[model samples]
Target: MTSIWDPIRIGRMALAHRFAMAPMTRSRAQADGAPGPLAAEYYAQRAGFGLIITEGVQPSDDGQGYLNTPGIYTEAHVAGWRRVTDAVHARGGHLFMQLMHAGRMAHPDNTPHHRQPVAPSAIAPGQTMFTAAGLQEIPEPRALSTDEVEATVRDFVHAARQAIAAGADGVEIHAANGYLIQQFFASNANRRTDRYGGPIENRMRFAIEVARAVSEAIGPERTGLRISPGSTLGGIDEGPEGPALYRRLVPALAELDLAYLHVAQGGNEALLGEIRRLWPNALLVARGGRPLERAAADVEAGLADVAPVARWALANPDFVERYRRGAPLNEADPATFYGGGAHGYTDYPTFGRALVAA
Candidate 1:
């Protein structure tokens, strides 16, 4: 049995330990959708994690859903992320940029162009998002045509290339979390009659296409993807055939031989075991809302190759060191979790380093 402290080789990259920092949305980017001023510092502080999967980065203008989130298409974006990558590398840490398209979960007020959001269908997410003014209801999005869908795949490839150019170790396509790709999987969120909707095979097409294109642009060893089975975020439901969909989808993805498969556990243990059996490469499991001990159990039991830590990593920059030392952890402040400067972002003290709490 492999322990969390043991070293592992994931694809082309060899890591010192089996723990990684999960991708998180901090909402601290610049007005132009570039990384925030303190972005490099924030990431480099968590360098001991060995592998650091960054926050979601938009691939195009249409992909932006939240305020001040980073993008990879623009020149400024590449330069901004370059600093982050350089800082992380200096500390002997590897970073993988996660490409995420928000789809219909976006509001006009939060975007740079203020244009209507785009998705597989025209349905709204029935959710309210915090904007510059205040909380506002998300409006219905326009449906994408078949031609537009193909262009979206190209956007992901472009983003992956840009990430490599910026000195990142790799890129992770965000196919989960009720985003654009997952929107096509949800029957309620997607009502199209095209090849992207209706059947399970059709729904999984967009994700497969994006993954294939990205892997071709960058080596398959540098590309990875994240998926959530049976997730209901962004007002989505995969219906009764949800399990069947993944039973087929996971193997189809495995055929691509991606660097790794990240599964965000969504209350499905048996299905998770099935996914472990299907994926031949590295498997990263994020057990959100559960104890860290449980996540470690997955790695020890050979169900997961890596344990991606979230809230605990967010609250403790030297999380690995503290855990090994059996020291106390600082509690994370919920109020400052999103859209903040240095308080909850980079002010987290390491073990025995006295600092004011948020």
Candidate 2:
């Protein structure tokens, strides 16, 4: 039986342990969508994890939706991230850039250009996103013409190339959590009659194209994708057809021979196991709602190769080591989750140091 602290082979990269740091968005970047000094130290401190998937980074200015979030399409952004990647590599960790495009989930006040969010269709998420001022209703997004959708795919490719240039081990396409790709996945948000909407195959078109383009831009060995099947966040609902969509998507993704498939499972063990069966040979990292013990069990049962934790990782930088020794975990401050200073970011002490103090 393998333990959570044991070494694991995840695609082309070898992780020292099976514990990965799940990507948690901290609106700590500059207003211009560039990563700041604090962002570098925050990621560096948590480099003990087998892998670090970064916060949703915009592929272009139009892709940005939240205030003070980072981007990857600019020279300055690449330079800024280079510092972060260098720090993580110096500490013996692998980092993957997560490219996200917030589609109908955008609020005008949250973006730099204040551009209307774009999606596969003209539908809106009917939810509000945080802005500099306060919570504002998400405006109806412009439908991406087929040409524009192709352009968006190219943009992701370019961002993936840029991330590799910035010293990242790989890139993970953020196709989850009601972003651009998920917008297409959800029938409620994508009512288009085009080839990019309607049936499951058409609805999965954008995501598949984006994944193929990114895999081609960089080697497939350096590409990964995150998906949340049947998640209804941001008022997205695909109804009964949701499961069928992923049943097709996972096998198709597996055929691409990409690095890994990080599935954010929200209490659907049967579906998760089904996906595991479909994605036969790839490194499947299962996340979402699994306790640490269950996560370890999932790996031992061959349900997944790694288990990612979000909140616990935020509070405990030395998560792998702490879990290995069964040390008490630091409680995460929910109030400080989004936009805050070093208080809840990099201020958590390791168990060894905490024990010494006691």
Give the clash count for each candidate: 0, 0
Residue lDDT tens for model 2, 129-227: 788788888899999998898899999998999999989899999998888899898888888888998889999988899899899889888999999
Show where candidate 1 strays beyond 4 Å.
355-358
Q: Considering every candidate listed, which one attains the maximal TM-score?
A: 1
**Would you list the C-alpha lDDT of every candidate in the order shown?**
0.92, 0.85
Q: How far does residue 223 in candidate 1 sit from its true spot (Å)?
A: 0.8
Question: Candidate 1 — what's its lDDT?
Answer: 0.92
lDDT of 2: 0.85
Tell me the alpha-carbon RMSD of every candidate. Answer: 1.5, 1.4
Question: Which tens-of-lDDT digit does each residue in 27-128 have in candidate 1?
Answer: 999998889999999999999999999999999999999887899998889999999999999999999999999999898888888999999998999999
Regions of candidate 2 where Cα sits further than 4 Å from its true position? none
Using lDDT as the measure, which candidate wins?
1
Candidate 2 clashing pairs, residues 3+ apart or interchain: none
